[model samples]
Target: MGTPKQFLFLELFMQLLRIAFGKNMVCYWDMKSSIGYRYSKFTSNHLIQGSANCSHLVYASAHFDAITFEIHFPQHDPPLPIFKPKTLKQSHPKLKVYLSLGGDDDANDKYDQLKYLHLMEGSEHAQQKFIIRTIKFLKLHQFDGLDLAFPLPRNQPSQQSNIGAFLNDVNRMWGSPTTT
Candidate 1:
């Protein structure tokens, strides 16, 4: 049997292997475990909650590149409490923590994701709202970046173009010195 440290090392090695050759290593944390980080086994019985956190695996990861906390759709508004940037930075200062923009978290979430994409595609006002809110969310939580995980099954060329435009706006806004 492998010791805990050995298992952790193996996990880290596997993640690095996946990230090799131009791929980025991004981990998904489930929506449910918002409070997992707030407790120890000594403090709460919710220790083994099914969510990923920097505490468990980040240290083992050697290169430590980047990790994104997953699934923040427009429907859910502000979702879970992600790990603080300061905490993750103290461990691996260069490691980037991003907030994932869209992914279906459940059956109902598929509907919400579709709506989210439709709003993004159809309404410039909605797009601006999303960008503003997302910027605020990132700044509030001190996330280093944002990751767009396409929310819908886009069919038309124009649909893809709309998403591209949305991302371009985000990139433009992201590079600016102003926070507001």
Candidate 2:
């Protein structure tokens, strides 16, 4: 699930996939641009507005199964509250939606702000707070699950350990099945 800020290419890709596979595929929008470090204030409205005119094209397309809008988190700040989609899935009740955490880049600074000295070994308190807040936000917006995208820095022992701790914390908080 790559980031599709404009959703134009994603729309076309879905169309092609439908033609080629003859199956309904899911389209998860891994929104890298919304991460706090690069896009702290970004919101779903940005994506919606950017691709406003393409809503009809996306909704009318027959290739997509579910369209999960991933919002990468790069801050210790509580996850952004979900904003209901105005177009896609308005008529479909079974479409799966999700709110993703982390991204391709490591959120070391953000983790530091949260007072988690080790990225991977966040305290139980920190993990619980993150998971609880995230779940609240997801439920508010009607999301179905979460996607943890914490990427470890390669060849860095300390960073890798931190990332491992982070994953462990996440697994403990959200459980294995909740991860995407």
Candidate 3:
């Protein structure tokens, strides 16, 4: 049985569905768990399809306004989807699927993700390139949008400003009718 909060959330979600005014309930799925095929059967049927079994129970895809696949970075080699996002989209047309950038990594070299995010948006040229490539990657992979998952570390003013500027650029690009 779920907690009272979970039940209340479900009730709210159901009400939203009835009224056709859904709240933004974002579900973040880590690439490692998704790619490893360790998802539950309910998840498989509703959100993603996989052969492996698990005990964890995930809410239906319709409950979420969007699902974000975590930890892809802006680089020359774009990410390839191990879990087929196209299938999920086809199954739940109203559910938005986003590709997230920057996340914690176990490997020491890739651990400081904020640093990579900074380097990606260090200059005007680099920022533009990152946005263009990200857009292209999203289009290619059928992603609804890009999620900048970079955390603003405490006392890091420069990093925060860079992230803010980069976000503004991203918003400008996506908000424009001409750009995709």
Candidate 4:
């Protein structure tokens, strides 16, 4: 019999194989969605900057499905514009691209200043307009879907409700594509 540590390592390796190939699982990572852009470092210069190490695994893993590039609305532009789909298509043809909105910077003062007045609470028409505009923008760029990353304090009831409404409006506007 092998040493305890060796056996544990072997078991872990087997589990990883099962999860990585044996099962038809799909894993997605929210790359560059929050305060830092560190995750981008590992991807290709086009996909992300620091994503070098995981680039191989991201390509090799049959279980990995899509990459969601988070965009902090009103704070930064979409990073998808810089992404090169050729690399991803070569490795995983089914890999889909999505845009995530309302990350950390969306709550900052700069974001507040630039916030679309139409997206304010209790304005269904305004919310619809915002969603329609986002869909059109993403369609123009060939994005698959939208991932709302709205971050609000747990105790803020009003903000949470408004966010829910916003999501509903977006879903309704985009029709929520089933593929991505």
Model 1 C-alpha lDDT versus the unseen true structure: 0.49
- C-alpha TM-scores of all predictions: 0.58, 0.48, 0.58, 0.53
Query: What's model 3's overall lDDT?
Result: 0.49
True lDDT of residue 86, candidate 4: 49
Worst 10 residues of 1 by lDDT: 58-67
> 92-154 in candidate 2: lDDT tens per residue?
444555555544433345432333234246456655555556565556655666655444445
Task: State residue 7's C-alpha deviation in candidate 4, in Å.
Answer: 23
**What is candidate 1's lDDT per residue for 1-180, written digit by digit as tens?**
335676477567756656563344444443344323432111111212211222222111011001121223333444433356566566455556666654444235445446545655666666656666667777787777776655466575655557677778778878877747
TM-score of 3: 0.58
The lDDT of each candidate is: 0.49, 0.45, 0.49, 0.44
Name the regions of candidate 1 deviating beyond 4 angstroms: 5-81, 106-111, 154-158
Candidate 4 total steric clashes: 9
